[model samples]
Target: MKLFNRFPAIIHHDDSTTAPSLDASLPARKWETILFSTVLIWTFLGLCFPMYDTDFWWHLKTGQSILAGNGIPGLDLYTFTDADKPWIDLHWGFQVLVAILYAIGGVPLVTLVKAGVVTAAVAIGWRACGNELPAWKKSLVWIFPIICIAGRGNERPEMLSQLFLAMWLWIAWRSEKQPDWMWWLPVLQIIWVNCHALFVLGLIVGFSYAVDAVIRTRWGGRFGLEPRTDGPPLGAVFVVAVLVALACLINPYFEEGALFPLTLYRKFSVEKEFYRQNIGEFRPPIDFVMQFGLSNLFVISELIVWLVTAASFVWLLVKKGRWSPYRLILFAGYSHLAWQASRNTNIFALVSAVIACQNFAAAEVIRSVSVAGSTAGDRPHQTGKRVKLAQGMTGLFVILTGLVVSGVWNQIGEKNKPFGLGEAPNWFIHDAAKFAGRDGFPMRAFVAHIGQAEVYVYHNGPLRKVFMDARLEVCTQQTFELYNGILAAMAAGDPIWQNLFREGEPPVVILDSRSSRPAINGMLQNPTWRLVFADKTGAVFLHIDTATRLSLPPVDPSPLMYPDGEPKEKSRGK
Candidate 1:
């Protein structure tokens, strides 16, 4: 109150009709309660998809390393190729979190935590959609956004970022009514910067609010509007934004961590061609849509929600006769982010849904509903019937959401992501991992599959080193190129592949059979390498010299492992 009194010109005035209070603590209507409950259940089930994210293993391992007093790693210790490479691990906080969760309950606990984080984020956004909108309308707008975000809902630190983002957005929205909520921004920023590289979003959200305050203050009087007194003072908001930005420097790396995203973006932009071609998340949504067609429900949901949000902006502009600068900036900022990377589509989905729902709430015309009289001009009976109909529709939508979660969204694009908990057994080359983790096995291996390499290193690292893993940021572009070259040569059955292998000096090679099928075939024909283990997921090869020195007999290389053929486990066959 004192802050607002000091700078009355900067407060925003709400011009909309008197509607239901936006307080979340207020008791929800019966239908709203039912709808929100069902939506959360649906969100939990949807995000509980099988853990196919291979990057998870490495992240968990890194977390364990941090917990073990090794501290947040400043050097690459997992891979032989990039040994001692400079690494600024911004995700140290998130890594420690997941590590602790895993220590408590292993993969099942991590899965539950992942589901809970995402469900909670969605719930926060749902609350921000405003209480004035009908329950059915809110749920309807929410369905597609939930579906869209579920595509990236695997176990990753980005999920934490999403939850934090939701919290920041809610704080920003409510700070007008509760000015002290703005102070939480800087505190959250300190946690966010150390957790994920996307922490800059907190600053962006604050900046949007501050700019909105400045604009409305300087120009509203000229446009024949009286000074508003709803929001916090402009100077206070600006101070908060600056404080939030400065909080980014509270990380372990301080200045470097504060500016790490820019450094990362510079590297990624330079190598965008490679990452875009190789990484599915980095690829445009259109690329997947074109390749997979409309069968991909996730892609379709993304498109629908995106288009509807765009229409919502137009609708609000026409109905209100003025745009909310805060919302416009959020819409544009997230729109550009989603357009650039498919990984960001989930965050964009949350923003778009909140904005669309809020717009509808603001644009809706208020009407009276008397307990003993008619609503608008309708008879009491008619109102009762409409209420029942809405209840039925909301119930039906909930059932359909369950069906989609259980059956439809199991797979996104070409990936086989089923709805469940725990890691997918087939995803990890477990047999090879077990064999490699043995007491006297070779310490260095050329890992052909990036995903398998992550798992392999988690199961066996420091004690063992890999040619490479999925730390694309730490690994040089030259290493990636050389790895690609080795894959190509091995696939072609060229003896030149042996020369490429010399660079890494790996005595053992491991690869996913499906991803590196041609290379497996080439290895079967090459006398220089001996197949020591083979399974459906991947195979392990020992150099002939290493096998001879160890007296390890080769597995039967007679039956060629075709891409379509499923081979039974083989170990040291006579």
Candidate 2:
């Protein structure tokens, strides 16, 4: 009886002991339908897209290697520059998962899987906001987050981390009703640690909840906060938090894997300015503001959402006279992350959306405005008019949502390829990679773009290696600097660039024509390098001597030249 009383869900069989479910408190069935319909629309918007992430191919390649008897690689194998560097492949599980999905149904299936994970994560965040808020309002607020997350919703393992974080938050918020759900967190953490470095977020959230519960247990009314009677016991929360921390060490690299996020975190600092400046995603939102001067709608939208979220925090504290320690901590932490790097905006958007809803609910400022209900004393005519307006607005919103998800609105000013399956045109140098994998081509080449390197390795890894890829964790600063130096020197038409190449660096060079145009033009003017292959996707260049030895014909430059013709000063300083 004592055990059953303490943990009724574990051993109790009697209906009398069962607590009311979290859903029991929800307002109406129509709102549930509305919420789900909105979610479905949001999810469809994500699914109707081709693979656009540049780093996705390498992750898939790593998974294939793992399944092909490589296990979790202790050293980098894809890069010639960092072949012997220690690699703590925390993305092994995510890689293996996508690899299996790819094997089953190819790129389309992987795209579907990525969409599913992101939708689940977003849905869970919606659920964590609870059911008291009006579904229409929730739907409206949800659009902001959906837009914010859309920028970083590429096919990446961070999607898995987002899912795990949502699950953790859901479990924490519902601990009072389903205390047993807290136990599932540590189990998820074990998988999370193996999948992505962001598993550390799980521990931070768990400890925040644990610490908040502990503080509230005795001092709930202190600091003008309302007393809470519904949360789980302090001991239970703390115990699970400890278990969650311990689960981090269950990965292949153990402590090293668990601590890998710290290493990634350090990169956001000023010391890694090269990475911060060179990597588009790593650059801060302020940099975009400075460069584009409020002309960027994406960055402006994110800032508006950030301000709204901050306002909600202040509103909850001042108007409600209550504060959630966990939420405050989350706001502080994620705010820093979002400000530090643009890629983290997705996470902050989700967090801000949930926290805003929770704050409004706790403040009792927002009431459930059900489409089906009105107060008893209200005039029938007024109620009828109000209901009709709500219905009309909702119907219109649904229609617009349908049009947007159908890729109608998406067609306007979209940078990505039109909605479809398989890889985007700009995603890879497919034909070039295939050409490089042939018999006469060099086994190693200078891949100028990091995104293109992922493609090259995916098509011809193990048998062929790149100068570098997207694995910045394994690739040292010196190698990255050297890569930049070579490109800079090559663009200047300097002979010194030849000396910057490593001793065994291949005579072949691969570059995305769109991104490395200057280098391409410079190489075109150089008598030493011959353009062996040229196409819309990318161009392949080889040393004049190597091209002669292989009997490969150099491509004509007339077709690749600009409309105005080739620049008069092709060589900067020959």
Candidate 3:
């Protein structure tokens, strides 16, 4: 408040006004309320798709397997191609939780779980940014970093990591002098290790804090509060860090749990060159900046974070004449992670709040620079600051209102509102029911794209054993390569495609006639597969063996069914 008062003049009146007028003080409190509401509203935007995050399918199935009394998946079970391969189901706990939610209320429950986690994350983050002061700086730090993280906040186990990140930050920053409360750090790590591969983030935070505490104890009186306990603070900090690492091994995978994040990082980084092109989130922030223009919201958010980080460093340099090594490391480590892959932006977001909050809460009025006195002249400036705060609150209200209205008003108008998940807008849902027929399907097969796969699962379309669904990780590297190989071969009129199909032929195949034109063409060219059904959204190709058993009318196969017999320039399309 004093630092804010240094902005020329404001919030100081008569030098003895113990508490300022409600009008002068209410805006700060109201602005905090506004920020809390904004975080909730924005957190929900993550579930803007009815069947968001196709990966949820495998997670669901994995959860079911765990509930089925099978041990947490220690080996690959979903893919037919990977019988010998070991699979690391790192997020087994999260999978079971969401699966239970889904079983109870279906998609609505899943959506709620996602919104609930992200909302909790943002809420915890708000506190981590500091309850001691709710300045525009904290709001800026909270709002902009959230925008960066929300890009990948979907219905995935990673959402659990995000929540854990916020909690870790909160507990970590608060445990500086309150060493008695540090025992919870290991408990949190145990849950984190079972919940997501990002458990390493918790370890990193614990280590950073432990080291920072040791340095502070050495410096004495420089890093805020003294250890509340009689013993040195380093003992508590070291105990917490060591136990956090040890707690990670409690998962079913044991040592694998300890090394899970390293393996996952290796999984992504080994094929880093390929993922940068294929995975949108793996693309660097600079790539987004180049492709999406400066005015793009994502880019703008990135810029805000980078600017604030740079400003924080500059502020530290000016005040202390040298970089506080720990602060610089915290900012640089997360910022670099975020810069490298867009998905890790959540790390930067939650950590930014911690860094800002911890710094703000620790900072003392530099006795050399702070004005020790405020005169009667400061009275008029209070009104100006109050007005500015009011404007900030009003702006927050307007933004929140716009989002709520945009999301809710779409019921009868344009039904596909982006602000939140709405009912499935495509006609495929209604159409697929008619095609599946009253009689049960003997088995379930593969659907090429996620939207189509979602439609299949939603309507209970059958043939069994999908080649792969939204859960990309459920498939082995060999299987994924083979699946794409089949699609490419079918599209390119390669004879090897038929040979590939002969290797692992599904009784039924569902694909988009437009986007999967090449695949459809290849299927039709084969006498073994017959086009038994068609619709605007997609078509179903029944193998010759199953075509006789199914009662649906079989359409004659033709090359002319698709435009130029080529896949759309954009593989997945409207």
Candidate 4:
């Protein structure tokens, strides 16, 4: 009888011992569930959208060129004026990948591939957040990726770098407990450094982790509550850092490619057009709320992060009595990045969500313990209610999923319609086909050939070099200036249209009958250029100086006499 009475107390102690182990397992399970959800959501969102950026044209053209035997062009080949200027393809690898996909599948397949990559990136970021945070806090990380996808809504290089950044952070965090894992850091850094210039961020994150390790060793280890270290041997971080830095030089242009971002930064700062114009990425974050017409969602999300951080700080003060230097550093870093640009809202959102989730998980564990103590008398009834509640929540989730799927299908259909997204004419495709075919055709033949050439190029022109294509960035400053100037002058009804007829113009200018009214009028009036071909789509102008002279009337020596001009009297008509 004495042993049986003592058995209850012994069993209770055993249960208490296993409770923490179970609690630890719950967080891991919760994190996995959240990460899976994030990937599915991001993939669905990406698949619902199409490539809508102006940069996509250049990406496609560059990819197409890479697919051909030309390899990466070291000189500007898009225009007659700057064909020999040295060219540096910063995005050559990305372009070549896209081109290979295009060759194998088509435009739609490329879109799907981009969407899939973005989905994977978001999944990686989501996993990092869950790994770093407590179970309840993981859900908070989901909101940021949601807002970021809605804001940017395109597959770009930054998306790829974001995944690498997340992976770096996760590895660095894990390295605190398993120093042997430090080797993977350099390898990841090497891949990231070559993939995008954003690889510089990996170095910064590594440095931060090293600083954190030093702080934790000096102060955190003394506190008794700090996590036990199984970190790598001495000088491991420095060696990895050096290796990662050197790994950046393995790109196509080597040092030039690695240092290209500095040049781009300088150009962006100095260029009036880029700085003065409203570029989507450069725009302030608050502006996105207005542009997208979101009702304080951005502000609310930001405040939620700040509020949770403040609460976490207070909780640390009351409970642990001191802040973890590493956490404080991360908080400050994210805060700075968030405030620097509106686009950085995503970064802030992810950081804040992770912190919030950690806090929530800690609070929930406390609540579960408190509830268990209070409800000890009614444990059996409480367990039954909890199981019913879980079932109800699952059913609710299923209903919501159905609604979201229906809405997404409708949205995808509306957004993917043909010509729903505007198509800019492929000037390079037209020009390349015209000049490469024959010596030179009449104006009409040139226009027909260029139009027909666009069709042929669309089908088979990958084998040939193009004069100009839709890849706007590959265009030299002179070519862009001339193209813009010609369009502007045409729009303003300027009389300087004869400049295009001067020696060495693009052999054939494809003039759409409806869109090229000004160019048509200019070609008709210019004495040195003649319209040798015309069709329903466009008219072609050829520089036939002799034929142009024969078509023009003789010049008169008399002053105040208009050449080929006959004065018409003003007439009054009813």
Candidate 5:
């Protein structure tokens, strides 16, 4: 009786485990469709961060000024501390471009341009993953790299560098076969100088190409490499190199812009420790791993990259392949960059994709050969399976192309929607103009204190240059420390807040009551400051030094208070 009972139980358990798995083999067409949908979905998802990068405000504002002023502002117009500090607007060209787009269709157009620019960069990077690979494998390989870098593709000047880097890689590869196009490399520096501060990266690419060509010619046998006879003759590269250096100086800043990268890097670095350590992006990789654990996506992605890089080295060794010195240099350089800062991971992805995809091609090529030359017994309908697989992949590429185009347009729509959830709302912005009148509030006289970027955009600014904005690097190095100290003192109920206002007094103050109760509490005791506006997003306090403060009636000291006696916005969320 016991044996019989056990036998039935065993039979049921076996059936339960095996039955579901028996249907594991998905059809090739369905699998391809699933993968295509998943990747496209993720690519679109990557485009969904809210515009919190304060740099956008200043950049857009600067662009607007350039348009109105009919030239780049030769001084910093948006800061009190650095006002008229002989500013070098290296991104003058990009600012004008933004001005033109914003003028054309407002935020929607600017959002679309950001998406389109990054998408085009992604396409260039996908192609630069190298030749001699199936389109399917190349696309699949590039997808993950895109996912890794998707976080950094916000509407900023860095996207331009991403595009330019891809362009340089494309030219570098083709220059092997058509070297005459290499002459145009210097011409790119002219545009790059006016675009972003990271234009030095472009010069690095050109030099790497020149060095690689010289090395292969001199060191063909040592690394099992043969001189690529298809490449440009090595002798002219020296003359072109000098021209590239000279070309970088053709900007309005002239030598200042050309040397911006060096000066900026020096400013950020102190001995061995970087001042960028204060920023999350520039922190050492170990800090992220320790803080977020091994499961952190950034750490996971970095490990996978290292694995892929190691695999490439192994593949090269096994195949006795000619590893292009330029590719190797790029991989090593960018890998170090990632190790140094979590933010630089995208650059690593850009360069390592090339190294990885090339190595991956050899393995994929082998699989391709195996599929075409399969043995008889294992697959009874080999020819049919091959045809189905081919049709599936071809269909997938077509659908992916359509999805990418459609997805970018969709992303633009997502970005254009008014501030919701993670974004800074325009409530304060709309009201500031009404309260302050046409002339606007005093510049840097009172702290905006909340949603720094949103204030600038909402006001249609040049109202008052703020003490803090997302344009951090452009601000003096000590500005953050100084601002934080002032904020801390106010929050601690110290009298230092009064002194700060006396010295740097902004006419109006925007307060986040929930997080800033201490500061707000201190202000409540001060008779001179009056609360003119209050909403769920923030509270604005006007300093009543004179009639010039504004024509609004005197505000009561007591605000709408919650149970804790601190003022709470009727509206919720920041």
Candidate 6:
């Protein structure tokens, strides 16, 4: 036993061994209590309020279809008009899981499920970092994920992608010291490729690992620091990359499913509306520079994550030797992503949090404190001042939690309305039964009566299938030009308005009042298209066709006008 203790350096223990006596290292019951408490607190604060623009309903619908034994559809199935259009089920696996959740419970259950998955992902990432982190620093990991959760709460295919990213990082870090562990890469890739289109990132990460391996091999021998390479390090990484690329072909659309994102990326470059439309994730942080109120808490949290990350990178270089080239490249990539949009800031925050914990845990300053018998540890520790500081901080957090529960946190409730127009208007259709009476209308419905209802020259919804939703980025350049042209023509009474809503146009057009003011105005200009029903939030436009002209009455223009003579202006000044 004395020899084992003295020769501890001979066998490399995992990083978690450093904190053998922390409360986090308690028995299984205590550990579970701590973990579950963290999960519950974060889930309530982060996942309970859904954000607008979360296409979760569509994902649920897709899952429902898959569960019904239809499997993954090769073409779009939700809309009647575009039912035959080619579509790829890129996120089939994730869809199936979400569908099962929806089927067993309802939408609320989805929140719980998402919360659990995200919490688990964060926990796994932290655990993978080992026990080198002190209790204070470890607690910060929970806060880090919370900062990201608000921006990342959307129910999209990317949720799975994010989880996969955490997993990949954990695995890659483990493989660094245990070369034999590289075999797990391919297995993870197989699952990732089937879950989300972001699996391409995994392939890129794998390729980087392989390149790093070759570099290490050539240089390590010269420096007397050779690592074991006989294991499947290079081979496993290569095989996984190839297999994951091929696994993308497992979807119903086969190769098209794999290539759809690339195609969309190319098409998105030329789209004007997509470029102008501010997705929560896409909006820049510059807008919040002047908002010094509590309303800016989310933005403030995001800025801290970015600033801390940048500082950590500098510290890593100055305190430790230069970081590995691969880590430097990954950090640079994250920095670029952070600048792209506010949403990308989550990625930066997560990466920064991990690096911060690792660096803080490994610092000589922290080690010296441990050796000096200060702070929380297994040894006889100092409790006169530092322990009191920790207890006071805990009390402050408890007060914050209490405030959050007593409706003070609900002040952010106004910001929590998920649907774009504050609430679903009376005209909104929550179920399919609402549309049964309007079967004669050739238009299709997508969640709450929002869908494409016309065919314009560049906007091909009335004739051809739409590339995606009514969002600007989903349409062709011509579609955006036509949309903008139509908007300009609305005030000028341009001839283009005549072509947009001719007599034989699509039977019905659903307009999202939150996003589509120009198209709605053009429809209102032409007398041939009438508003069947209008509400404060949204409206439905029906074509005055020969088949259903008598069933629909002339819409009262008075409802659409303000108390004054002017038309109710919907657009916020651009």
lDDT of 4 at 502: 50
- Candidate 5, position 172, lDDT: 73
lDDT of 4 by residue, 1-574 (tens): 1111111121122232123322233434444454446445544443444454445545556567777766876766443344575666656667777677777876666666665665565555554443333323344345444444434534445555666777776566545554545667666766665556556666667676667667666666465325436564336766777777777777767787667666544333445254223334444545555566544444555655666776776675566554555556666776765554554565555555444444433333333454436554454464444444434444443443454455643343222312211233332233323433333332221222222333323433334333344333344445445555664464454748445645543444445554456666665666555555444444555556533533533222221122123345422332
TM-score of each: 0.89, 0.89, 0.78, 0.64, 0.76, 0.74
Model number with the top lDDT: 1
The per-model lDDT (C-alpha) reads 0.76, 0.75, 0.61, 0.50, 0.60, 0.52
lDDT string for model 2 (100-182, tens) is 99999998888877777888888888878776655555666676677677667678998898888888787777775667668
Off by over 4 Å in 2: 1-28, 365-375, 378-393, 405-408, 411-414, 501-505, 558-574
Per-residue lDDT of model 3, residues 462-486, tens digit only = 2234555544444545566677777
If candidate 1 were superposed on the true structure by all CA atoms, what would the RMSD be?
5.1
lDDT string, candidate 5, 28-96, tens digits: 335433543444444544554445454565677778777777587666665665665777778878878
Q: Ranking by lDDT, best first?
A: 1, 2, 3, 5, 6, 4
True-vs-predicted CA distance for residue 247, candidate 2, Å: 0.5
Model 5 spans > 4 angstroms off: 1-45, 48-50, 271-278, 294-299, 362-440, 446-454, 457-463, 501-506, 512-528, 544-574
CA deviation > 4 Å runs, candidate 1: 1-28, 221-228, 267-270, 368-386, 404-415, 500-505, 557-574
Count of backbone clashes for each model? Answer: 0, 0, 5, 10, 5, 3
Span of 10 residues, lowest total lDDT, candidate 2: 16-25
lDDT of 1 at 465: 85
